[model samples]
Target: MTLLPGVRSATVDTDRLRMHLLAAGPEDGEPLVLLHGNLSTGRFYEHLMPTLGERYRVLAPDMRGFGDTEPKALDATRGLGDWADDTAALLHALGIERAPHLVGWSTGGAAVAAYAKDHPVASLTFLDPVSPYGYGGVRADGTPVTPDVAGSGGGSANPEVVARLAAKDASDESPFSIRNVMRALYWSPTYRLPPEREDVLVAEVLKTLVGDDGYPGDHAPSPHWPGVAPGTRGILNALSPKYCRWADVVDLDPKPPVLWTHGSADLVVADASPLDFGVLGASGAVPGWPGEEAFPAQPMVAQIREVLDAYAAAGGRVTVEMFEGSGHGPHVDAAHRWTEVLLAFLVSA
Candidate 1:
């Protein structure tokens, strides 16, 4: 399909899996890869892509079993690290070995971090929870350990939403919990949503619950990592349990200027103070999202403070910005503030 700013995409085979990546902008332009959240595909960015495409070479590829891509063999072992491998393969196939800017959201944040640590990404722009929620970098062979998402609540807690979602199994389709949580988002829903946009995100609910073909594009999934290759199920089995713990992964080295923004209202993964993440320097107060259950649950606020403080003290180039009246994905949910910061980061960084 036609993407923002005349950018387009098609499926290519890197190895076994079919990969779909945005094919927009000049081939030689500086590259920027957009990674989506878990259980989400690149399709979500259909509306947001154009904003970035106006200036940079943008590519948003769907991960395995998500979005437009077809499901893999599913021995079922894939986890976060494999995603990094997928990025590596994508870059290799595209002949891009040098570092490029990566704007990763949610789990995509973790995947990109893994890529940056090993490869040369120009920088990382993180939105909301930085990554792996602590339960990262677990060795595939290590014993499986459930991540301490005990803090999945982030730094804020919306008790009403919690009780509502907890009450019913919406049906196996939407995964009772995920659907209910998302329910608050829609009054109407989305289908042939627009720049059109969906109201209340009804269509997304139907698909997630109904298992419809979300990505109706002509392309296939990326093969860079493996199309449920020999080791996918193994990867999933070893890593799924540890995904939300906030301790397993840390940014040992960050390349590309990092711009991070979280909602003052986010309870899922409240961010450290602006001074900590470098968003505002020592001039601002450390914002808190008491409603979120993620960070506070695992001492995330303090941990983030420690990291931000250490990074700043160490002269790390990071920025932590905030938004009010919003939650985790301020970019998608509260586009104005997010877009301003994002555009600034893209141009300035």
Candidate 2:
């Protein structure tokens, strides 16, 4: 991968795992930890880090199962705790005594939330994070569609897509190919990554470990319409509501200021996310939706707003910014504006 000038790569052995990271800026600069989402690595932030490095010590680590981090099975039952704790351990190991500004993208947003709850942080910034409740198969109130939380987690991952990822199929011939998936889903459909940058991002995704303990993880059959439930292990299951739930973050002691930035066009974590099985089935995109009551489209954005509103009501500081034209990865699709807003938030915080 072609790294920006001043960016360096290293592996730090924390108590929990060996975290491979891309770091920039002065070692003594105020720390800003950038956490990437699922199917991505620290390299995902390579371009964003350099500018931020001018003012902050930027460290972006590939969480346990992705990139150069040692492959380790995530204990899905603990939800995002594994990732949070790993992040804490890495900070401590690196001798970062003060709480760093935490920035998380997508699933990484869930990780930072879990981290902020159990640990102290200067501030929290979520870039199109998953809902405070979890992903799909749940109501606006966070109740599961089925008792087992069917139609969510690892089982919800498309088998064909997972297979392509496993095979490291870089071809864009099919929608399932990693390249096409990134091109079609990772950013705004109207905006495309430059060829070289796309190559690097795709390579970073291919580094993910693919198995029951890896990317999509494991699942079990369910009686629900979608007919699948979270298995007991792996990254995808770790995101399942059965394991991941952080609505109580509003109650976190020493509540930090939260800056939530999202794209109005984000399809991955929207009220009617296209990636959500319930939405797909309901829209006739997938057969046998079983209608709204049995399996309603997950109101992911609403769930996040509800929790954030509660946080505000509870006397915590929160700000929301919606980028109109960007998709899931606004930092990429709307880089200049995203950077300006993000920098202003960091500086003011």
Candidate 3:
């Protein structure tokens, strides 16, 4: 199962724009697109894909506003809709008439859901993602609403509820916390980047960050800092773009195998990814609005259960699995268990 064997780069130009992607696996195999979480690019799946082998053709694109594809098109407003359009264009450019299996993490998950709904994907996976509400932010029982901002443990009063929702996770507070250097190593869980590497990471993001189109480069930062930092709000503020709800597109179509994953204890996206969008309203990430508290973790934890439900409701083909005790990108961040879960679900599909 050596799926994505190495770093392979290609730029696919749609009639609308050019998309840069790092890919691996058999070109002729069943197609699968790995959408990275907000902070990094598709390189995040660099390890996970190598194990999938020829089982599927895996393409991890630097979405319109991310990675090498930065300085996105005016059309590429960092809006999830623009992300979906590029995804569709990428498929069409590659002659993938049938939608491949779509696996989205964090913001990418939101993109996957918005696109796969109408795109005819074989299956869908929300890999430990934040759906706008608390996809990555909640506990199984629902407690800490924010993972980044320092909290008095008081309810949110920040213009945006999510912004003030800040609280640190155990890992973020650990002496070994990976937060400071995470941007440099998309796939490195045990590894941390040195200063030189950190410099490179910053340069990379900055270089691809803004385009001649006047649209700023895409750099999705984490919602919270791991350690208690005073500038958590400032950091988030700098990273955030004007809010555009990806959930608004969910109603466009709804036919596909939908799988959602989230860590009950994840402090990253944390229930931020909206499952329903509450009729298409903004979450706390927007400026000038109070940050919203996350949904109870019980329902968030039920994503896998919902996948099973999708299976039961849709006959034999099931579309969901739970990555227990995992954080962020389950298959990549918590590969040991979630990888197995991913394989099982793929085979099931």
| lDDT (C-alpha, whole model) for all candidates | 0.49, 0.90, 0.50
Cα TM-score per model:
0.64, 0.98, 0.60
Q: Candidate 2: where are CA atoms >4 Å away?
A: none
> Is 1 or 3 the stronger prediction by lDDT?
3
- Candidate 2, residues 1-349, lDDT tens digits: the string is 4579989999999999999999999999999999999999989888888899999999999998899999998888888889999999999999999889999998898899999987889999999998888888898899998999998889888889999898988888898898988877778889999998888888889999999998798899998878889998888998899988878889988889899999988989999988898879978988888988888888988888999999989988898999997888998999989988989998888
Off by over 4 Å in 3: 1-6, 73-79, 132-254, 271-320
- Top candidate (TM-score): 2
* lDDT assessment of candidate 2: 0.90
Name the candidate, 1 or 2, with the larger TM-score value: 2
Instruction: Report the Cα RMSD per candidate.
Output: 11.4, 1.0, 9.9
Sliding window of 10 residues with minimal summed lDDT for model 2:
180-189
In Å, residue 269's CA in model 3 sits off its true spot by 2.8
Global local distance difference test of model 3: 0.50
Model 3 — which ten-residue stretch has the worst lDDT? 152-161
